[model samples]
Target: MINQDHFSRLNQYRSMWVLVFFDLPTETRKDRKAAILFRKNLLDDGFSMFQFSIYLRFCASRENAAVHIKRTKSRLPKQGKVCIMQITDKQFGMIELFHGQKETVPETPSQQLELF
Candidate 1:
């Protein structure tokens, strides 16, 4: 059994979101290939495509988020700019999304059960 207070506290403060934004050059065949591979690597690492050039993943904690950040750095392409940002789950929940002119609710992070 899990303590409700502890679980709520973890979700409220300890959880994190990792967002990666990149602008890679694809002027040549090799460049395009590299960009494609980079996207694939991110997908394999559990990142979801938030946009064509932006990927985001939810981590159980800041430590877990750091590991994903390091993985993202290791696969960065040599020809473009890549930025990674971390935000708490609380901050992420405050994001307001929209489509066209209508306001939309931000996506809820997928539930991730962590052991230890």
Candidate 2:
């Protein structure tokens, strides 16, 4: 018989990856400060810099992802384009990355344990 623990382990496919991409106007001093502050907020929320304007965080489930997305929206800068996307862990694992002409694998974050 499949146990609850085993069933729980099989649900990893439902895990989520939240990605934020932004292009903020940094020409003016105020614009620059806002951009910096936006980035800081993402970091404070446990997101890691995936690139200059890309940040990502892993969430255990869709509900958890929604919480982070809402937090991100509340802190958005006023004068730039920002996009937030969520994908399942299975989809995220299939992404291919490149550095210049060399292909690279994305760094997989350590699995986070969820405690009820």
TM-score of every model? 0.87, 0.87
Alpha-carbon shift of residue 84 in model 2 (angstroms): 0.4
> Model 2: what TM-score?
0.87
Clashes of each: 0, 0
Q: Which candidate has the highest lDDT of all? A: 2
User: Per-model C-alpha lDDT, please?
Assistant: 0.89, 0.91
Candidate 1 lDDT, 37-108, residue by residue in tens:
999999998899998899999998889999989999999898998999999988888887789999988777
Kindly list the per-residue Cα lDDT of model 2 for residues 1-116, writing each as its tens digit. 88998666566677889999999999999999999999999998889999999999999889999999999999989999999999988888889899999999999886666565
